[model samples]
Target: MRNTQQRKTEWLNIQWKGGVMTHPVQQDGSSCGVIVVLMAREIMKAFPNVPILQFGTSRKEMANERKMMALQILKASVFDEAENCSMCSLKKPTGSVHRFINWIQCDTCERWYHEKCLGMAKEDLEQARANTWSCILCS
Candidate 1:
């Protein structure tokens, strides 16, 4: 039966009296939820003895930590996916030439490979636009 404002006020009062503090305002509205979750987890991990309400970290520091964590996770996922690929035997292809070419992916194995590795010419790839090319292992 409590109104929203009254509920919020009660919550704030509880937090204030309990020594729980507020995190800084998010710079962007888009990732506020993510920031809050990440900050809470990090704070809990770093300061288990401290009350969460009393624990505070700068928004800049939290954002930087979040960014770095995201990058590390992404890199790890990429590495895992590359390891799963049977064609290159876990070695990612090097050189700008490999980057420029339109790589084909296997439907069955979900592994990616260069046209040259599959013995498919550029013209052949162009000609077989609508056809799905399966890798040799899958074929």
Candidate 2:
């Protein structure tokens, strides 16, 4: 028999308001699990009702803290730290010079990450490759 009494925290909305940009809640950004949508799916499997909370802050102090944390994480992003490669930095003109097509190369693998795609950081990706590592998605 399964224990229905044990309640789990499932849904989380992480709203970030930076300068002029705000990214809505996302599961991956919170480091909670795989895709954010999957969190809802998993919760549905175990319980009918799930508790959700919005992370970060409504107050200035908390907001500052949240911003700092975000800065730290972003600083370590592959775009900032990884070595640039040809395939990673090419762009196609869109209007007069090419406005619609911009391409990015993977820091570790040197493959292309298109306008709407994201990839693992080169350092982490390289470490994984060297250690024979595979993530859940890869595995």
Candidate 3:
């Protein structure tokens, strides 16, 4: 047979070199994306050495993966890191706070940080040598 464009495009089933491996069937409707991402992570971590032991994910595990994936999305996010606290560096800090009061700013660089994010506790505020306290980078 002559080499042809049709044959090249048609090579999927007829020309497959290695045996195919099947991913486990999705159990939950919403977990499809999570399962795909989980599979990729598992492959990257274990390929060429260890074999994957399981792929049947439970609904509870999917829920956990959803949170984990959200966190990963935030941490691996493309948004401006400059807006985040230099210490924790998360795009947004959690919980209720009065920004002007609960958040503190460095006297030097002027970067803002959540009170909980600081290494110093509220009690340690009195122990500070001077009224002005610098952020970790500034100090």
**Which lDDT values do the candidates have, in the order given?**
0.60, 0.45, 0.69
Best by TM-score: 3
- Pairs clashing within candidate 3: none
Return whichever of 2 and 3 wins on TM-score.
3
Candidate 3, residues 52-83: lDDT per residue as tens digits?
A: 84755888888888898899888887654356
Top-lDDT structure, candidate number? 3
Question: Clashing residue pairs, candidate 2?
Answer: 88-105, 93-97, 93-98, 93-99, 94-98, 94-99, 94-100, 95-99
Candidate 3, position 32, lDDT: 79
Worst 10 residues of 3 by lDDT: 94-103
Q: What's the TM for model 3?
A: 0.37
Error of 3 at 30 (Å): 2.2
Whichever of 2 and 3 has more lDDT, that candidate is 3
Deviation from truth (RMSD, Å), model 2: 22.5
Provide TM-scores for the models: 0.33, 0.20, 0.37
